[model samples]
Target: MSSKTVKLLLVGIGGYGHFYIDGIEALADQVELVAIVDPFPAQALDWPTLQAQDIPCFDTLDAFLATGITVDLAVLASPISFHADQSCALMEAGVHVLCEKPIAATIPEVERMREVRDSTGKFLEIGYQWSFSEAVQNLKTDILSGHYGMAQCLSTHVAWPRTSAYYARNSWAGKIHNAQGAPVYDSPVANATAHFLHNMLFVLGETQQSSALPRKIRAECYRVNPIENYDTACLEVETEKGDRILFYTTHAADANDGPSFLYRFEGAEIRYEIGGDIVAYLADGSIKNYGNPEGTHMRKLDVCVAKVLDADGATTPICSIEAASSHTYCVNALQQIPVYTVDPAYLQVKEIKPGEQLTFIPNMGVHLREAFEQQKLFSEMNFPWATPMGAAVVVCPIHS
Candidate 1:
């Protein structure tokens, strides 16, 4: 028997769109990229290649939807501000959606999306791709198998740097609003640190469990840059299940410092160190390392697609809407907190000091321009966006 090919329509061929393509290519046997929509024409340089391979490209989503593309799935890679609107539009048009993270800018928006999804009976999967990591999967299996007894504590650190140039590259680079009140339009927890928190939730199997809402959240944020957003934050959350999760993220740090996620159980500890290596230790002096030095984050989406295609009626572990929403809620909450403030005048000025070395800013405008120039640029692209060049120095001397 021939396998049924699931047709896909991808929107936003910029950052994460490239990852969607990689995942689609990895699962080409089970899926097909039928159409693509990206607002910027220059961003579609690879359209000819996809077109030659029988995929249609459109400049707008409405045009693609009206083209009778016959796609079963819609992959949304638009900016955070458009997530809810685009997802709702796709689902209303009877297409299942796999949207990029921070499901929506606000809880109300998330609720609206959920309502639309349920009313339309179309599946909505918020893309929290880290849940599909091998290390994360193995940890989930171990946790579910009762090997760790009960998960007591989870801690994650996602300290990375971004330069002033990064914020200056786009008009919306570090802005609080996109003419919309959604705090996630530009924020650290919403854009960058979301994955760390999501990975922790995934490992703990708290994504689908409603008995585990975070009861207490105490967070402190710092805005070293002039941009009206927090560049770094440290959070302590206590879940109703008695599990404590500590999360730290920064947009200002040395370029060489990569991201890390760590988890601790009663008798076992697991660490996903920088450079894609997983290290674990058991109480009985057993230590193991699972390294994927060449692994790209795109593989996470590949795994998610495969699982969704293979699952029965219920949503798969990776593509479950509820699972994604859990992560989204936490990220949105973190971004919504008015933890830090910065002056817009400072944002416009270039600060310089004697003997201070120059560093490049990882402005979103620059990233978007690069993406506009390079159609193949994806979310995990080792560009300046992820690795900002300058030091994030906290300047607020007065404390309230």
Candidate 2:
């Protein structure tokens, strides 16, 4: 906390990094960009406006940190694998941090970063921007206020489409292994559907609970594409309170014409339909809609910054490393299940008319043979690279 204006640094200026530029412009009055770091030198060259402003841009974090620049906060949009090391370094340097979600690749990495934060006493906010959405905040207030009674069940669905070219665009997009264990950090729940899962967790107030943990998780996964990762999955999770959660995510289907994701409570529903707008329903049969606006994640980050600046030692409601770690675990659990293909015979059997003679086309055996052959082809092509060593469920001990 200083009397001077907040000076911020941007790290990893790639896809999401560019989106942060919009956020910076929105909050330009309160913050100034002192520096930017990206390995791709062309990224900075591509942005003439940012370049013309005389903002210092470097190709590496080591180079930027060596400049001895005085920055109050570091906005991390780096790759998922780099989060822990970069965050720990910034915290150790006495700069506050706003990091992207799935805080780190594993639970141990998350714990280490938390330890750094505790020792340095610097603010750390994991960027799960959906928590800051207007709809999410309203739902949280009502749920905590007992407006919905008790949350009996929760359901979340994320259905979007990604082509083979999408995975081919980046080397790490479909990987489960880098220098460390299985990158376990690819499509579906971990990337595309992450916000939906996080929103469900937020509305249910299932954040960082050590007493009532998820006791059981059963999952079914499918690999529709030729890649080495699952593109679709369905998960059923049971909490210690006996509450059930049904979570579904897929990147194989065609994009929906209407809303792509939805959240349902006992008496309320929130829709994030095709146009990117949000609508909520309450127990009183009232409806509220937030115009189909974009940059919702950026707004969440703004609130996160505000919370860190205003804290006198109270916990903030935004996502934390611990909560993000739990989410990573949830994704990992679902990925361990085997993929099953439906028999195709059920798809083509025609019904006979009352007066018509039945042509007994014995195609069931043929269809089963084709199904098994297709299954083998898929398994041989993908499973070798997709299967990771640590996909086993690791249940944390529940503390009273």
Measured against the true structure, the TM-scores of the candidates, in listed sequence, are 0.76, 0.77
Clashes in predicted model 2 = 5
In candidate 1 the C-alpha lDDT for residue 156 amounts to 66
Residue-by-residue lDDT tens digits, candidate 2, 1-400: 5334568898976778887888888877677889988877465434678878888988878788898998878999887888888999998998888888767766667789989988988878877765656656665666666655666556655456565566655667756655466464575777766766656555665433211245566555556555666665556566656665656666654433222445555777656655556776777889877554344758755764565556564245356664566576666665556554323332222233343221111332232223222422222324322233212333332211
lDDT of 1 by residue, 1-400 (tens): 2367877888877666776777788777878887788876355545556767865668778888787768777888888888888899888997878888767766678788879988987777766655655665665667777776778677766556666666764556666776446555566666766777766666666533211355555565556576776676656666656687766666654443435555777778877667767777888899867554226566545544554465464243354555555555565455545544433332333334443332323353333233323322213234423322222222111110
Candidate lDDT values, in order? 0.62, 0.62
Alpha-carbon error at 292 in model 1, in Å? 4.5
TM-score computed on alpha carbons, candidate 1:
0.76
List pairs with backbone clashes in candidate 2.
176-182, 176-183, 177-183, 259-273, 259-274
